[model samples]
Target: MTDMIERSNTPVRRRSPGDPPTVPNHPVGPGRLRVPLLMFGAVAVLVWIGIWIGNTQLTHDAFFPSRPGIAGGTWFEGWQRWDAYWYRTIVREGYVSYPGVQSSVAYWPSYPLLVRSVSWAFPSIFITGSMVTLACGAGAAVALRRWVGEFLPRSAAITTLALFLVYPFGYYLYGAVYADALFVAATIGAFLLVERDRPGWAGVVGIVATAARPAGMVVAVALLLRVIERRNLARAACSPDAAAPGPFARFDPRALRRRDTPVLLAFAGVGAWSTYLWVRFGDPLLFATVEENWGQGAGPATWFKVRVFEELRDKPLAAGTIGHVVQGLLLIGALALVPRIIRRFGWAYGLFTLGVVGLALVGTKDFQSGGRYLIGAFPCFAALAEPLVSRPPLRAVLLMLSLVALFAMAVAYGRGTYLA
Candidate 1:
C-alpha cells in the first residue's frame, strides 16, 4: 500500500529545453490548434443561425434604422441594428459634427473606413461590414488560442477559447456590424506579437486597435508593461544570485533599445485621429465631447445614473432591470479576477484587464454595454478557464449558463432591442 501511494504521487514529465514544446499530456504538434479553430467556426455558425431565426420570427421594436446607402430588404439587413446605423451613417456621409449633440464623430473611424474600403468591391456596406467583423472574429479566436496555449495546457487553452466565444455578448463576434470584433482581433494580435518578442509588429497592430475603439489606448499601456517585464526577466536571468524583479520594479533607461521605440507607434492611430479632429472640428478631443451627448461622462453624477439599485427597487424582475443586474454582476466578477490574472499572466495582462474594466465602468450610465465592453479584457476569461480545466462538472455548468445568455443576447440584438 505504501509503494502504490508513492507511485501515484509521481510528477508528470517535463520537456527538456532542446525538445520541441508539446501540448501538456497530449504530445501533439501545431495540429493541436485545428480542433479549437473548428470549434470556434461551429460556434460562429450557431450564433449566426440564432440571429437569423430571431430576426425573422420575432417583431422588432421601434428603433433607429440604417442610413439609405446600406439599407436593403434582405436577411443581412437584420444585422444593421443599433450602432450599425451610426457606422452606416459614417460610411455614407463622413464624420460630421453637430454642436452639443450626438453625431457621427462619436463613433470611431477604423471600422467604418474598413467597411467603406470593402464596399468598393462588394457594393453593400452592410455585407462588407459583417464580413469584416467575422474575419476579425476568426483572427481574435486564433490569437486567443495561441496566446493561452503558450502558458497553459491544451485543455485550458481550449476552455478559454470556448468561454470567450460563448460569453454573453460574444454573439457580437459573429458578424455583428460593430467594431468589437475588429478591436478584439487587433488587441489580441498585438499581445500575441508582444509575447513572441515582436514589439514592432505589435505596435503596428496597435494602430488598428487604437483606431477601432476609444478604450484601445489600453493596448499601448499593456505593451509597455510587457516590455518592461521582459527586460526585468532578462536582467534576472543574467544574475542568478540577484533577487527577481517584482511586476512593478523600476527599470533602467539604458535597457530600452531601438526595438522598443516602435511601441510608440501604438499611439499613432489615436494621434492621427486627434490631429484630424483638431484640424476639422477645431477640437482635438471632439470624441470625448460627443460622448457626453450620449449620456456618458466621468463624475459622481455618472455613477449615480448607473441606477442599478434604483432599477432593482423599482422593478426587480423586469427585463431592463435583469439586464442591468447581469451586467453589474459580470463587471464585478471580471474585476474580482484581476489579481488572479496578474499573478498568472504577469503585470501586462492583469493591468490590461483592470484598464478595460475601469474604462467600461467610469463613464457609463447604468452599465449599458458593460458586458460587451468586457470582451476586450480577454485575460479574465483565461483566469476563469485555467482552474476549470481540471473540473468538468463546474465547467459544464458555466458553459451552459454562458450559452443560454449568448443566445438570449443574440436573439434580442437581432430583434432590434437596444442591447449594448
Candidate 2:
C-alpha cells in the first residue's frame, strides 16, 4: 500500500534501459498492440449511431426540456432532463440561466466559455462543442501516439484516439451543453505534456481541466508530485554509496528515483480540489455543489435525487453522505487489475484509469447514463490499450470496432435510445 501511494506521488522518468524500468509485473514490449484496436473500433460505431439519433431527438416533443444556467440548475424548465436542458439553456439564456444544482458553472468556465464564444461565431452549441471536442480528440490521438511509445506504435495510438472521440459518452455529452468534450481534449493534452516532462505547461492544462470537472483535480496532484521530485532531485542524486546510512542510506542502490512530472501534478490537483470543496460546503471533502443542491448530498447522482427523499435523508447517512461507491469500487478493481493486464503502461496509462474512475467514484456516481462520467478520462484508453491489445493487426481491428461503436453510440444518443 505504501509503495502504491509513493509510486503514485513520485514523478517517474520515461523508461530507459540504464534506469531499470518495470511494467505491470511483466516484461516490457510483450505482445503487439491488437485488442485495443478492436475495442476502439466498437466505440467508433457507437458514436456514429449517437450522432444520427441525437439530431433526431432534438426536434421531437416526446420529452420536455429545462435550461441550465452558468452557475448550476437555476434555469429549470418543466419535464426535460439534463443534456437537453443544457443545450436549450446555453443557447437561450447564456451562462447565467442554469437551473438548480447543475449550475456549478464555477467548476466549468472552459466549456461554458467556449460555447458562448462559439455561439457568437457559429450557429449552435451542437456544432461548436462537437467540432471542438472532435478536433481535440484528434489531437489527443496524435499526442497519444507519442506518449505511448513504450507499448504502442503510431497506428495503435491513432486508433485509440479515434475511438475515444466518439465514445458512447461523447454522444450524449457532446449534444448537451456541457464541458466534457473540451475536458477530454484538455486532460489528454495535459497527459501528453507530462509524458514529455513539461511540468509547467502540464500544470496549466490540468488547471483548465479541473475547472471543467472536479475530477480534473487528478492532474493537479500529478503536478504537485512533479514539483516534489524536482525539488528533492538532488537528494535522490546523491551517490549510491555516499554514506551508507540506513534503509534510505546515502549510497544504497535504491537511494535514487526517476521522476515523471505528470504523476505528481495529478496527485496535487486532487488534494487542492478536495480542500476547495471542503471550504465551499463547510466540509473538507464536499464534491460538486450540484449534488448538494439536489439533496443527494449523500446519495448517488442517479436516482439519489429521489432516494434521498425516500431513504437516507432520514437514515444515519443524512444529508451529506454522497458517494456512488459501488460502481466506483468496481472501477477500482478494474484499475488494480490494469497492471496485470498490460505491460509497463505506467502512470501515463495506469494512473489515468485510477484517477478517472476515482474521480467518478467520488463525484460522478449520479443521475447520468452509463459511461458518461468516465468519458473525460479518454487518456486512460490511450494508456490501457497498450496492455489489453498487442499485435498491430489485431489492435487495429479492435480500434476499428471501437470507432464504429463510437459512431453507433452517437446515433443512439440522438434518439435517446438504450443499448442492451
For model 1, the local distance difference test gives 0.80
* lDDT by residue (tens digit), candidate 1, 153-193: 77888899999999989988888899999999999988877
Which segments of candidate 2 are over 4 A away from where they belong?
A: 1-50, 53-61, 64-81, 87-107, 162-167, 170-176, 226-287, 299-337, 340-343, 347-352, 364-370, 387-397, 417-420
**What's model 2's overall lDDT?**
0.47
Model 2, total clashes: 125
TM-score of each: 0.89, 0.60
How many clashes does the backbone of model 1 have? 1
What is the lDDT of every predicted structure here? 0.80, 0.47
For 1-420, candidate 2 gives per-residue lDDT tens digits of: 999998687654433211111331221342223433333335434454445455444543345322344222221111123454464465556443133645543344556566666666655555555545544444444444444553455554555555455443455333344566566667766755654557667766776676666667665654443233333333433443333122122223332245433344444444565665556555444445455564445444433335334444456363222232233443554566545322343333445466666655544333222266666555456555555455767666765675566565555444434321
Candidate 1: Cα lDDT at 361 = 80
